[model samples]
Target: MTRKLHTLSTVTALFAGLATAHGLPATAEAAPTGQTVAAQDVSPSMLSAMQRDLGLSEEQIHRRLAFEATAARVELRLSQELGSTFGGAWLNEDGSQLIVGVTDEASAALVRLAGAEPRRVARSKAQLDRVMDELDRNAANASASSIHTWYVDLPTNSVVVTAADSVMSKFQAENFIARTSGAKDGTIRVVRSAEAPRPLYDTRGGDAYYPGNARCSIGFAVNGGFVTAGHCGGVGTTTSGHNRVAQGTVRGSSFPGNDYGWVQTNGSWASQPWVNNYAGGNDVVSGSSEAGIGASICRSGSTTGKRCGAIQAKNVTVNYSNGPVYGLTQTNVCAEGGDSGGSWLSGNQAQGVTSGGSGNCTSGGTTFFQPLNPILSVYGLSLTTNGGGGGGKGFVSRLNGKCIDVPNSNFSDGVQLQMWDCNGTNAQKFTWVGSTLQIGGKCVDVANASTANGTPIQLVSCNGNRAQDFVLSGAGDLVSYLANKCVDIKDVSSASGAKLHLWDCNGAANQKWDYR
Candidate 1:
């Protein structure tokens, strides 16, 4: 469920023949072909998940990746060429085309000649920056401001202001914006939002970091440390990792005016270049190449593990009751407590660090992130990449961090499995070779390869068929490739010798399996 699933404003219709277009629609990822799985060099886990959510074909997924990669380069080139006139850029609904925003006709012409559609906007991105600066200067006076945000919507060509309908009066908001130096008619427009945003900070969970007694998730690994939400800590604030080990201290931090901070790691902890998806793979960091608006994006945090959405707005300001944060990027990604300071990425590129937003994961919600470019530039830190890092074997265990096992170490085809203490035995290991869950290279199979519910589960030779395919869902349900039925606990048994079977996924403990 994606929260704040709102688009700034309607723009020109997307290219024809695309399945209906909408903002942050809840959908599943399609299973990628084996060829595409390799050709894209992405974790098959990631691709299959995206295919379920984004409704894209293997070729479309390939093109989206290729498009965003090339668009990053093109955007940088156009930024240099158009300089101050460059307004913004975005991906089309199908993600097959790109639109670059520029101020002047000359810049638009240049963009057209470069093979991208160009649109003229009233204000340049530089002008929007100036306006945002003015908003920051008025931050203190506007602390009690509306729904906590103002940003230039590339499509609307207006600085969109957000206020909670029940809190700040419309009159009060208008007067505040009118007083801001650069905000005038057609310059700033107010919109009502459902909830007031805040810096999502906590110390109650995984990837836990205790900075001033608050927990935060790692944003992304830089040179000496990782970056996170500024609200998580301040200069000299000592922090500890999930293991209760002294990990690092805040080297630089900021909030309200800016929502980013970086910590300097101690020798006890080694920073890795990849973010753990917890959905079955690690997303490698290749570069921080920016993805434009409407570009499909994903996020990783200790709480939700990995969830994705699209960038809804940028260069935005959110006026929290604590203060106001300027230059934050808003998204439809669902984030909850303990997810703040997590990483927002598109493909392998780093985009930003989680800041704050309203709502929850179960009911859907909105989130904001401190864009990475500003933090990197401000701190003079270079991003780390996966080329220098190695990942785990991608095998995981059941809840309690133990193994999903076959009792007695049986290699016979018909043995039922159970969850037991993991000792790193070969029987405890499982690999996703394509979509099959293989233990000792044998696929977890349905009895007689049938799709019927309550069928006994067993191990069989890899057949490259539906019986072998499985999906590791975000909810920890092992859904089958055949009938969409779940791998279930036989007769809802919890003790040893409880046989595993295929049944409906009813959200019961018997149906849930934890993976490390």
Candidate 2:
């Protein structure tokens, strides 16, 4: 099951809805009204699970769950009045108290009426306070002697700390082991290393780039460049080859809030469909299709290199020391500092780019990556094929047969098209002869086959046009003609009037199309 940390403070009302669905009383049900009495009778198994997993004993579990039950009741009543406007609910880290965020004073009053101790604080203020507390705690600590940095797997919510030669480090490692005993876990030992923690970079010989890296495997190459993690390199940063040869420069970068970046290259380097050399074995290049939540995935990085694991969750928002990053996919795959910007693939289909993870390969950990589709659409680049062994014909045929009519109102000729129920119509029939798409016996050509959005798609009488042929390249962006340009939406949109236009395809969500 997928697990996410929801703030009881932000969604106190939502949980109240959940409680009511589960037959619990609303918050207005007072202590003497017997609701509290019912909550006090929580199941023993539930308490036991908390004790075993969270390290809470019976009494602690009882107190926390009882408090949660009361809070949940309060939330239910408030939510009915506030609906989607209700923010969220969360407990203090210690689990001793609860906080509920509301939209306004009136909403806060409703929360208070539901029995919660409502506090008025701006969202930014609350977030800043949390960051300051973390910063203060980190600053007050003078000794690295006793403190050892460990990696935590976001997918599993597990931690792994390396053992040091020092007695203190050894103690810390042992303590962690003991604390995590009797759970689904694994571990490995490695030599103690210093905590000179700097931002992990993909290094070639010597030169450095903020958000672009050299040693990492390219997700998929387009005509101009490729897309990877923004934390790898920032805008205008230059990249070089493994031998420090000039390669590309970062065109865009977004981090601490969104983990994505793209690099425009000088054509000295080319992208391939392959991921992971796998120690000289054949590499795996995945199709653009996304896998289900429980699907398996394998990662190839410069550090941990290669490891396989399962996806734990999608759309997870992680709070890192730098800032909060949203829309990251969490996996059990192991990774390290230099591994950022590596590729994550599922069954030879591209999945995403390595963003960050909490642990190393020695002990089990969780990691996250930026999904590749969005990165492609944002830049209008097409992914190169693995080893130049063009994709299988069967795959292409299947995609064509599944094409469904997307109303022109919903999508234009150049718009990134999605597959819906097939209705056996000319609009749904698309011929993928090579890399172009022919519709209605005419070429559905991008004006210049450019990757930019807002380039209108026009129907031209077919003449074996390259601009008409399209390929669903890496991460679901359609590549067209010899130009290597992609079918793009004028803008990243889902609205009816969003025109379908073509621009140089960079991997971005706006250009990623899904075939059902």
Candidate 3:
């Protein structure tokens, strides 16, 4: 088979043209435990897409990302702490808080200390997983046409059997559940659904790669190439780029049971730490920290552009017409034909690649993604990230073209930054490493990790705290992720000795920088 990829080069060129563009961190100076960091490098277009699809305001989107980031951390901590007693965790409807399912009062108390609300459940996550495993083992003996899909719904603490919406299908579903061990233990719940899931075929003009005559979206850039849906192509399949140029060949593929594949590109192509925003630009891929259930997630595909919704469930088994695929994450985000293998993200964190689903963006539909980590692990591939090679290094300033300088060339911790004439010296240069800005081995940090207005910017030891994370928005603002505030010159001063601080992002010249 043969395939073609979208033009990431075009995105690069566009960004380069806009660069004539714009443009963090510190402290062990750490954030408060479990505190949610503000959204980083969230593009205007990306935010607009989320607002349109998720019915949220811009402020709401920011708040939700912060809450979701914190919730994911809390979920991870509680899941590890509770172990077998952990029933599972998810975000609330609005994503304002995390709700953990606990099988014991002791576990519930532990969850509370983690700053998550706990709900008592009869079964632990391990027990529910066992039930789901039993059903998966018996899947070959069951009717896939009758049971459209099945998943371990963490919120309900039960294995949800989504059967086809027909009387005969319902009858078969009941029989199938009856014969399963979960039915005997009352751990299964049956529901009717009108879904006929299938792998989306075809791709968008510039964002798709043709696998023979079939088309699918490019997932994410890996060290040597990019990953996509396994169904898109088989191993050793030759491929081309969306520009119709010679591209690469599929190196690994897993379908039916899994839906992920990676292609090994030729030297002509370079993998980038970017996902198409579908707005003629790219969204920076900083890292791949997974988001918790009920958190808002967005997808980028050639066919649909960008779509947003909440994660509905994980560890889902969808019985497509061809076969059953396991370990897919489910979402309310709508997808369509030709949208398969696209990118899925929760805020800037890469989640997975599109698999198969039912419905379209016009109405509403359920979508699934093959989680990214598993793909990377299976193929022994390294994810390309902004911290790796995508970010820039240079003087960063806006007004009067002053540089963000480290006084006296000092590299000591807690040295406040000041504006200076652009002397093209090392002290005036900053390197963007992922979401953080660094100068002289130290990060540009907000003092005490404070998010309050007027918090002075200073030098601090390299740390991955939000206090040191900053993003150069496409519009030129150098904003801090800790509070979504801008790195502003104190009182809009352009003097060589003007101090730097954090303030409300007002799009003023002082808040903007030429760091892109």
> In what order do the candidates fall by lDDT, top score first?
3, 1, 2
RMSD of 3: 12.9
Q: With candidate 2 superimposed using the best TM-score fit, by how many Å does residue 235's alpha carbon deviate from the native?
A: 1.0
Better model by lDDT, 1 or 3? 3
- Give the per-residue lDDT of model 3 (tens digit) for 198-243: 8886754126776665667688887788889999899988888887
Measured by TM-score, the strongest candidate is: 3
TM-score of each: 0.64, 0.41, 0.70
Best by lDDT: 3
lDDT of 1 by residue, 1-516 (tens): 011111100011111101111111111123334322113355554566567667776666655765554444345445545677788777666665677888878777667655568888888877776776776667666645454677777777667777768544676677678877555546778888777787787722115677856677778776678888888888999988877788889999998778889988887777676777776557776556567787778877776667777788887778887777777888888888778888877776678898888887788888988888678667856566553322112223343344467778785777776666656555665543334566644678887878788897788766656676665554556767555567876776545556678987576767766543
Candidate 3 is scored at a TM of 0.70
Off by over 4 Å in 2: 1-200, 203-217, 386-516
Please give the lDDT score at residue 18 for candidate 1: 13
lDDT of each: 0.66, 0.49, 0.75
